[model samples]
Target: MVGIGYRKDFAEEFSENTLNPAFIEVAPENWINVGGYYKKMFDKILEKYPLFVHGLSLSVGSPEGIDVAFVKQVKQFLDETKAVEYSEHLSFSKCENAHLFDLLPIPFTEDAVKNVSKNIRQVQDILERKIAIEIVSYYTPIAPEISEIDFINSIVSEADCNLLLDVNNVYVNGFNHQYNPKEFIPKLDLSKVKYIHMAGHTKVASDLIIDTHGENIIDPVYDLFQFTMELMQRDVPILLERDFNIPELEVLQHEMDRLQIIKTNALKQHKHAIIS
Candidate 1:
């Protein structure tokens, strides 16, 4: 399935019935205990599309450990909304009980593996449902004891959780770290991936690319997405994440249509290869 991220910036377009996606994703922290107009708009959107929640908290890799109270609230919200899926960044965003509002990269070490696995189990137990964790983009890379790919494989296996594969983040990290994005996709446990994210990035310097979900997705990221689907051998839901530079409703719809075409073509290629 294909979808768009629900943002209030497109509230008018949604009311006019211009945007049509199979599903929509939103950050639950923004909606829980909310009231009035936005809440009403969200309820209307829910009627037409399945709701998928992506969280900003949970801080699965933080030293502060899991926040039981926040997760309990999330469980309540998910049950109330009957959300189809929930996801969070694999990176940590909290330190010393204060929200950093940034997706900071976790150190690739054996100790971190155990820490993250325990945190994820706590969340899953409280929610009583598995949650997907996205491989986030980061500008800095600290002294890592293990490789990024190995670190991810270990966590997902130990935690027994799924993944929200962010194609754009892979492209960005590949560029910044001087690795081949094409070669990198195959190393991951693709079977663990439950959802996908595609977005745009900005080239601030000749060598650095920032994961800015502001511009239209470039051709390379799209290429990687279609390539990833071929490996999966099945359809998985993907969402076009345009969190900034809010474009016109038609523009977002056009992107969704292109994704549908690519998704369809990739699956056909896979089936044709099998039959051949």
Candidate 2:
């Protein structure tokens, strides 16, 4: 299945007969406490489709630690909306009292791993749900002490949490950090992956691929998504993100159609493998 993030710009474009998405995702922060037109719009969508919350401000890896109050509020929002899943980035977006406003790579150290795992456990307790952590696209590691795959696996295993695999991040990191994206995949605990995300990035330089999510889904990112589906050997719902410079609703529908085709073909391959 394929879905797109909820955006107010195209709010009017969504309805039962028009550009129907398998699901709709929104940042809970965007709808936690808004009123009037936006609230009604969201309500309408909720009536028709499955809702998923892709969180933005949890800052799970922040040294400042998890915010108990915010987690409670998010839980309340989830309860109200009856969202199926909630996901936040594994990287930290804050330090001390200052909001960095960008996802920063957590240091690759055993101490960092322990801290992040503890935070995830606390969040799970508060939310009363298993929250998936997204793999973020980052330019550099805080330290060269551990491989990215090891850092991720250690935290998820320790916390006993699910993963929100982002194919675009894998492609961007592979290019920026000089590694085969597929090689990184086998090291990961695929059993933990709950869903997948794919988006577009900007190739500013030959070696620097920045995850912008503002452009069209590039060929490489789609290739990576297809590769991931083959590895999983089953159907998993995928969400397309366009947080910046979002195009028309029709364009997103077109992308969704393409994704559906990929998933259809992948499932057929999987069935053949099982039968043979």
Query: Which candidate number has the best lDDT?
Result: 1
* All models, RMSD in angstroms: 0.8, 1.2
Candidate 2, clashing residue pairs? Answer: none
- TM-score, structure 2 vs. true: 0.97
Each candidate's lDDT (Cα)? 0.90, 0.88
Q: What is the TM-score of each candidate against the true structure?
A: 0.98, 0.97
Reference-based lDDT, residue 46, model 2: 90
When summed lDDT is taken over every stretch of 10 residues in candidate 1, the lowest stretch is 11-20
Please identify model 2 stretches exceeding 4 Å from their true place: 15-17
User: In model 1, what are the clashing residue pairs, if there are any?
Assistant: none
Q: Give candidate 2's error at residue 197 in angstroms.
A: 0.3
Clashes of each: 0, 0
**Per-residue lDDT value at 198 in model 1:** 89
Residue 129 lDDT, candidate 1, scale 0-100: 94
